[model samples]
Target: MTVSTATGPLRPRVRFTGLARLSPRAGVVASASLIFILVMSLVLPAVTGYGPDQFVDLPYQAPSLAHPFGTDGFGRDVMVRTFAASRVDYLIPLLIVAISVIIGCVVGVAVTLIGGFAEWIMMRVTDAIIAFPFLILILALVVVFGQTVNVPFLPNGTIPIIVAVVLTGWAYYARLARSQTLSLREMDYITAARIMGYSTARIVFRHITPKVLGASVSYAIGDLIVVMGLIASLSLFGAGIAPPTAEWGQMMFEGRSVLDQYWWVTVFPLLFIIVSAVSLAAIAERLVARLEGRTQ
Candidate 1:
């Protein structure tokens, strides 16, 4: 309440902290979308009862209630194949983000903590990697590696793409983490830790690392969908996972040849990619917004 002698009623000052500052609408939509994506990508695919390679009908049949996505040239259900592709499509990006974050954070944190020539060298290396057009490098690596690599355990295309993407992917997060860490170095507590003669490892790990990692990891979550798109796009150039694997890009590539005559083959997979991408992207976009809000 305003003081009785006050000239006018005082307005309530808004505090931008915690939940109050975040958008309820965005939070709700993101939660629902995450649940939907998890269910569709993980749960529904398991229960579909059609293997991506199984023959289900005559080749090139039109879409119907039974086969919602129609039959492909090999008589496989296109819808089932699209769902099956989730293992390849989603998993690669998930692994990429997780691996990148781990490798990047270690390198980033070390370089920032070390200082001097070590830091200078690593930063230059990361900068050089980052300076390249990201997509071009990853694609180039994938194409080159796909030809020469032969491993009994890994699929032909998977190994090459993973190597290519990871080679370039971690550098981005390393740079980002370094930038975040540089700011932390100037903070009073970090300076005090140095003045107090705290061990480098102890000070960085105990005080500074937590603060640096939270932001990097949160931002990494938003980067997931972008990585997924890049992996999917690989199939467009016939450089992704080979046939019989049920990847979305491969499906789209094959379907494109017959798109005019048999539209469902191409349309359904495209629709799946669009719907899933949009859904996952909604979550990513909101998270990034909230993160920006935190910084501000």
Candidate 2:
């Protein structure tokens, strides 16, 4: 006679072991790196004795126990300036992303929901904006506006950059949201909501927007790294944040003159930029992977 088999709830088994765990491990490390950078940026100013523009050291001083990242050509501590620059380097992209996402999602959802002429006009406008070369358009706006508009809270010189970036950046999100909305609008749940006599606004907001937002958000994460680079490039070209601001691009520009002798001046800023971009990019990748259900 066969022994009676016992049937019970199955135990959960390990899904990832050894090499299979690398992706999650990398994601954790990337997240940790991002958090560390953000925390250091926020906390360093309070804890460190030297201010970003404080010139307590000799010009082009090499890295030392006293001045960790060395001094710039102006005799200012590189470490302090790097930390100070972190504020804008982080802030501008964040602001750009926020503004773009809001405007884009609203316009995209509205146009898609309304359809017909409104959608046509908005699509044409978006196409026109997209037709222009990205960097050139930003430069044109900055140059045309003369880069001196005084916004309430932002730095005096940053108004044009913000305006330009926001104007240019939002189109991408709008297009993305529209594409997602078009597809999501046809889903069974959306049709069911319509059949259930839900108002158009409720159906779009409650049902469609959330699904579209996920993809848009993933794109925004990747776009942050790009926006940061663009800001740095603008500063490098003398069109972004001005001097005395301790921005990474400006810092690198200042150090270019004596790069051979005083490598740390430029090197530190460059290193910081690279690290910031890489960390953001890694986080974006993980986010996209998780959104796509590829993450284990």
Candidate 3:
């Protein structure tokens, strides 16, 4: 029943009508910053002709036109490595969050649809997972799985970390999805679908899912940055992507020892993390507003 926009009705159970004009200029800045990071991380590494591990200059060289972010302890270009790290730092969380959302929405909707004993058991299980100290749980899981797990094309510890984060992260989305589904089920479209003899699957998928999904997406956008930080934090504990592979956390961990004399190594990587996270956050803020019809 709450599907209409301020102007008029859009679609039943669909909160989204169409794109809103983003009033905030911050969105453009955020988008540009994100684009720069993507280009630096994904494209220019090849153009620069420097491997992230390549010792291109004397170690600890200060920033220059040749080496804009200077060089680190191993003479690896700090600029290249920082951006290169984004490939892992950025992509991993996006992947983890995406998988979590899929699993969560399925579990959430399923539990509600099933009802009774099975639903009770699953919600209890989800609660248990969510109640635990998430970081410690992820660390322990990463360590346990990383020892035995390796996948082709994935960096070391990548698969294990993904497995660990997703294992814990999905519970959150499930709770969100379940709450959304509970409200949506009371809406007229769902009641009509039930009365019309539409298959349970059709009603749920066609009607409920589109509506429930928006909430999950809104919930998860901010989590992408959270998961990125988590992965970077893990690297500091010696459980990240391993040495020689440039990860922002790993770079920061290595640079901290010499940071008193060499600020570039630590500061540059940390700055990238900050800028990227801030950009993402800005985008998410406007996007959520855009979704909720709060924006002009």
Of the candidates shown, which would achieve the greatest TM-score relative to the real structure? 3
Residue-level lDDT tens digits of model 2 in 1-296: 00111111121221223323456665577667767776777677678766787788788889999888988878898888887787888888889888988888877877887789998887777777766666776777777877677667676468777787778667766777787788778889888887999887787677777777776665676677777888888876679887788888888888888999988888888888887776666666666667778865
Residue 113, candidate 2: Cα error in Å is 1.8
Backbone clash count for every predicted candidate, in the order shown? 0, 0, 0
> How far does residue 283 in candidate 2 sit from its true spot (Å)?
1.2
The TM-scores of all predictions, comma-separated, are 0.79, 0.86, 0.87
User: Where is model 3 more than 4 Å wrong at Cα?
Assistant: 1-23
Per-residue lDDT of candidate 3, residues 111-150 (tens digit): 7766789778867777677666766766787767763466
Q: How many backbone clashes can be found in candidate 3? A: 0
lDDT comparing candidate 3 with the true structure:
0.76
Task: List candidate 2 segments past 4 Å from native.
Answer: 1-23
- Prediction 2 TM-score vs. true: 0.86
Worst 10 residues of 1 by lDDT: 1-10
Q: Candidate 1, which segments miss by more than 4 Å at Cα? A: 1-27, 41-48, 133-155, 195-197, 294-296
Error of 3 at 21 (Å): 14
- Between prediction 2 and prediction 3, the one with superior TM-score is 3
Q: What are the lDDT scores of the predictions, listed in order?
A: 0.68, 0.74, 0.76
